[model samples]
Target chain A: SQTIHQWPATLVQPVGSPLSLECTVEGTSNPNLYWYRQAAGRGLQLLFYSVGIGQISSEVPQNLSASRPQDRQFILSSKKLLLSDSGFYLCAWSRGGRAEAFFGQGTRLTVV
Target chain B: QKEVEQDPGPLSVPEGAIVSLNCTYSNSAFQYFMWYRQYSRKGPELLMYTYSSGNKEDGRFTAQVDKSSKYISLFIRDSQPSDSATYLCAAPSSSGSARQLTFGSGTQLTVLP
Candidate 1:
């Protein structure tokens, strides 16, 4: 079975501090990975997605960037965080163009 | 207009009652429809996936897609308190590797015991 793992399940960061969130998948290779953020009472917003290593497509312009260092390892990072960057971040993986997506436990970021 | 729209309902229902969650989309190019459930502060879990138009059932859950109307629905029979969560609707376009998913503003459901 395929599973996704995300670290620092909860994070509290000071404004303008650097941020890093990691996601890794097991039991699958070459799967597409995605980064999404959900604000309170809002829909899931697509931040970035990667098809392969070193390839990332960003949907929204922000202070954050994503990288695929390995076939199953994806990282979301920011040099300086903003108050607006606080939200629940999710990592998801899918096979090819499939509609079914498997998500990790998610990271709750609180920027104060 | 947004590509996908869903009512963000804090809908409260009694246990054992039937629950209906819905979403509508304006994009006709979307070929894949899915329903996801998310607990508080957790990630959304895929519950149902359907292609084109028709109905698919899995256990107590039934997913219905009407492409002609660009509407989708998820029905939960014999609902339980454990089913309390937010339901999100997602659709992927036919563009393949682009594989972007458009999401609806989820509806929060609570099954009162």
Candidate 2:
């Protein structure tokens, strides 16, 4: 069975601070990875997605960026965070032409 | 306007009652539709998905898609308190480079015990 691991479960960062969220998938290779943010009362917004290693596609230009360093490892990062950047961040993956994605336990980040 | 739209209902229903959730899409880029269930603090879990138009059932849940009308529906039979969660309808967009799933605002359902 394939599983996704993401961390830290919760984060509180000061304004202008850096952010890094990591996610890894086991039991799959060359899987498409995605990063999403869910604000209160809002749906999951796609931030970034990767088709393969070193290939990242961003949905909307924002303060965040994603990278696929390894086949199953994805990283979401920001050089400087904003107050509006606070939300529930999720990591998901799908492969073999499956449209439905499997999501990971999200990280609740609060920018104070 | 959002590509996919949901009621975002905080609907409350008695246990064993039937529950319905719906969403509407407006464009052709969305080829597949899916329903996901999210607890209060966890990530959304894929409940079911349908590529074409029709109904698919699993245990206590049924998913229906009508491409001609661009409508998606999920029905729960004999609902339990464990079924209380936010139900979100989503579809993949082919217009953008990401080609990832676009979601609706989600309907929060609570099956009261």
Candidate 3:
């Protein structure tokens, strides 16, 4: 069985501060990884996705970025946080060229 | 217009009632459809997915897709309080060689006990 791990579960940061969220997958290799931000009544917004290491495609242009350092390790980062950058962030993985996605427990980020 | 759209229903129903959720997409090129369930303050969990224009059932849940109309539906039978959550439908769009998912604004359902 494959499992995705993301941390920290919750975070409270001041404005203009840097942000770093890590996600990792176990029991699978070369999986497709994605970062999504879900707002209340706004739906899940795809921020970034990576098909392989060192390759990242950003869907939405904002204050966030994603990186695939290893085959199963993905990281979401922000140089400076904005008040609008607060939401429930989710990390998900899927098989290459497939649509069935498995999500990790999300991180609730609050930028005050 | 958005590629995919869903009714944002804060629907309330009694336990053991039948529940239905639906979504519509604007793209006919979307070959795959998926449904996800999200609890309050949690990540959305994949519940069902299909590529063809038919119905697929798993236990108490059924997923229906109509490629001709670009419509997707999910039915939950014998609904319980645990079934209370937001249901979202998605379709994948081509992005380079990879694919990025586009999701609908979820429909919130509460099954009271």
Candidate 4:
């Protein structure tokens, strides 16, 4: 079975500070990875997706960026956090094509 | 208009009742549909997936998709309090990486004991 791990499970970052969130998938290789943010009372917003190492496609333009440093490791980063960046961040993985996605426990990021 | 639309219902239902959740999409090119359930403050969990226009059942959950109408639905039978959560509908676009899913604003469902 495949499992995705994201951390820290909860984060409290001060305004203008830098941010870094990591996601790693075990038991799967060359999986499609995605980063999504869910605002309070809103739907999941796709931020970035990676097909392979060093390949990242950003869906939404914001204060965040993503990187696939390794086949199973994805990272979401921000040079400067904004108050609007507060949300529930999720990391998901799929085998490619129309396969069902599996998600991690998610990280609750509160940018104060 | 958004590609996918879903009612943001804080729908309340009693235990053992049948529950229905729905979403409508504006894009006709969407071919694959899926339903996801998210617990409060948790990641969305894939519940059911359907391709094109048809119905698929898994245990207590039923997923229906109508490509001609661009509508999709999820039904939960014998609902329990543990089933309470937000439901999100997703459809894959026709463009690159058809696996990329476009999501609808989720509907929150609560099953009372």
Query: Per-model C-alpha lDDT, please?
Result: 0.92, 0.92, 0.92, 0.89
- Model 4 agreement with the true structure over A1-112: per-residue lDDT tens digits: 8889999999999999999999999998899999988887678888998888998998888889999999999999999999999989999998877557788989999999
Worst 10 residues of 2 chain B by lDDT: B93-102
lDDT of 1 by residue, A33-102 (tens): 9999998777989899988999999889999999999999999999999999999999999897676778
Q: Which stretches of candidate 4 lie over 4 Å from their true place?
A: none
DockQ of candidates 1 onward, in order?
A: 0.77, 0.63, 0.76, 0.66
lDDT tens per residue, model 2, A6-98: 999999999999999999999988898999999988898889889889999887899999999999999999999999999999999998466
Weakest ten-residue segment in model 1 chain B by summed lDDT? B92-101
Judge candidate 3 against the unseen true structure and give its global Cα lDDT, from 0 to 1.
0.92
What is the alpha-carbon lDDT for the whole of candidate 1? Answer: 0.92
User: Distance from true position, residue B69, model 1, in Å?
Assistant: 1.4
True contacts kept of 1: 0.67
TM-score of 4: 0.96
lDDT of 3 by residue, B27-78 (tens): 9889888999999888889998888799999999999998888899999999
Could you tell me which residue pairs clash in candidate 2? none
Q: How far is candidate 2 from the true structure (C-alpha RMSD, Å)?
A: 1.4
Give the per-residue lDDT digits (tens) of candidate 1, residues B1-113.
99999999989999999999999999989888999999998899999899989999999999999999999999999999999999999998644485878899999999999
Model 2 segments more than 4 A misplaced: B95-98
* lDDT over C-alpha atoms for residue B101 of model 2: 82
lDDT for residue A2 in candidate 3, whole number 0-100: 96
